[model samples]
Target: MKFDCLIVDDEMELAETTCEYFNLFDVHTAFVTSAEACREFLREHEVSLLLLDINLGGTSGFQLCKELRLTTSIPILFISARSSEDDVLIALDIGGDDYIHKPYTLRVLLAKVKAVLKRWSNEPIPEEDGGLLQAGPVQIDTKLRRATLNGEPLKLKTMEYKLLHYLVQHKNRVIPKEELFSGVWGDIFAGDGTLNVHIRHLREKIEVSPKEPQLICTVWGIGYAFEGE
Candidate 1:
């Protein structure tokens, strides 16, 4: 069976409530109380998005996210009470699509989830010339939402792919932080820590050495520029 959304939370009451609320609005949602249950559920069903909590009793949601990344690119939104910037950064860095602080209103969360699904269903932005985008050793198939390095496939999550696609599309120009945030994430409120971590992950995938990246260069006081050979 295919589910539109799955809420993986140790807070059973909150998870159940969220699931019921989403289903009430025709969202087709489900809930699981632990990371193990989440894994088991995925094995048996198809899920479009995940509402994950940071702490899952004995199992860490971050670990589960990392593990899932090895196989699937399902969008994950972290919903937790941990409001620390460090926690948010870690969540985004480790493949989370978005992070929502706890004590959230059900309506707002449902709207956000619907918005994400809608965005996922939309067609990828195409190049002016049209066709595959090749720069340096990286090649992006916009239609497929996939990127390859040196002809090898890269396992990029949704946000990572969006960031890379935007950067590569506008290569050789220094893009300001605010512009990249708004352009790629569609939100100017996205934190620098979140952007920085995503950039590091991108560097690790495309650069010969993440310590000395040659493609995506930083402008120190400003932002980043993609200088492809």
Candidate 2:
């Protein structure tokens, strides 16, 4: 299977150049000039990662990152001319996995992309795959990527599935946010809120009550764990 990436930058020259670089590395990247183009491309195709710029046509890439995070859990790498510390924090805070300032080395950019993709690759859900990984009444299929509680399937998104899978695989252990981010989301460098959102969503689905999460438990400033009998 070909790993695909979408580059959303209004800088047509730089976008094409980067596209060429990715092609050289067999990353199979495609370029879009605007956020609308990105929306359209993603609707029809599966993307492994996103190379986004903060200034795209008149819209901020950070805004688009949050919007994308609402639906998909694709890895987001921010490449922009804005090198301010505040800008970097804001980008990572809003679901961006990597922050790259402009005038960057093409080799460095390529390396970062490769590193992120190697770390986090979401597998496709398979059929005839229900083998319940049960802890209490909550069950998750290790292969099929589905979770059930009280015999009802939980419609988990990509990120939620990953979080649940990792926690369940390491059941009874407290997983640090850094480890979770690296293992599940791919460690290009993502935001805390990204993990929080997915964790909140998973609790809502797997736990009987999101307010009092039973399945996905938090460990204060540490991270989260999946505990069951």
Candidate 3:
């Protein structure tokens, strides 16, 4: 009924092999070969996370991810051979949590998956001074694990929330990319592309004009800083 991970890939052999490897590591994984099968499987079982391939039979993983995001916020990691920056950006724009290129090492993939699972399963990081954190027009309720911009709720993904929380926690001070990786993601393996895309997403949600952001500013060659009123 409940699975730790599900691989939705048209490449049956690869999916099966990955599934086997995850299971061997006690991850409770499963595999589905098409968008339809993936939908059916989700209807019947609970999956903690998804490993989705961009190319699926008849329907692309992009389509499925967009559809799924309408209802679920579960972590979706896109696995594809398409290594172009465009594809990676598209995947993140369409609600994917992370992108993993093809020819991945099984152990590395497992470690990433385990890290995500741990983040979702555990409680939010406790704040020494627990309460609301305001940065300009945005308000972060650390206790409720929710954020609001201009009095309206901001629909943030798991990592987005973590990123914003960390930024607001140290408002007006530059936070290096390395510090963000360690503080928010709890792993330094995440690339700048991943962090940049998430920051763009956050800007799109909270800024009146995302093109000219006021709350979150980039300190070129350094990192980002959250400027509050």
**If both were scored by lDDT, which would come out higher, candidate 2 or candidate 3?**
3
Model 1, 1-229: lDDT tens per residue?
9999999999999899989999999999999999989999999999999999999998899999999989888778999999998898889877887888999999888887887776676676765446588778888987777889999999886778889998988888999999987788665545577788889999998899999999999999999999985
Candidates in order have lDDT scores of 0.87, 0.79, 0.90
lDDT leaderboard ranking: 3, 1, 2
Runs of candidate 1 exceeding 4 Å displacement: 125-158, 172-182, 186-192, 207-223, 227-229
Model 2 quality (TM-score)? 0.65
What is the alpha-carbon lDDT of model 3 when measured against the actual structure?
Answer: 0.90
The true-versus-predicted C-alpha distance at residue 26 of model 2, in Å, is 4.6
User: Alpha-carbon error at 81 in model 2, in Å?
Assistant: 8.0
Question: Model 1: how far is 119 from its true place, Å?
Answer: 2.4
lDDT of 1: 0.87
Error of 1 at 226 (Å): 3.1
Model 2, backbone clash pairs (residues 3+ apart or across chains), number: 1
In Å, residue 130's CA in model 1 sits off its true spot by 4.8
Candidate 2 clashes between residue pairs 3 or more apart in a chain or in different chains: 97-189
Which candidate number would show the highest TM-score if scored against the true structure?
3
The residue-level lDDT of candidate 3 at 106 comes to: 93
Candidate 2 lDDT over 1-229, as tens digits, reads: 3346889999999999999998998989999999988888888888999999999988889899999999987788888999877887787667776677887788878877886777665455333325556777777876666777778888865567767877876788899999997788665355565577678667777777899987788999999888886
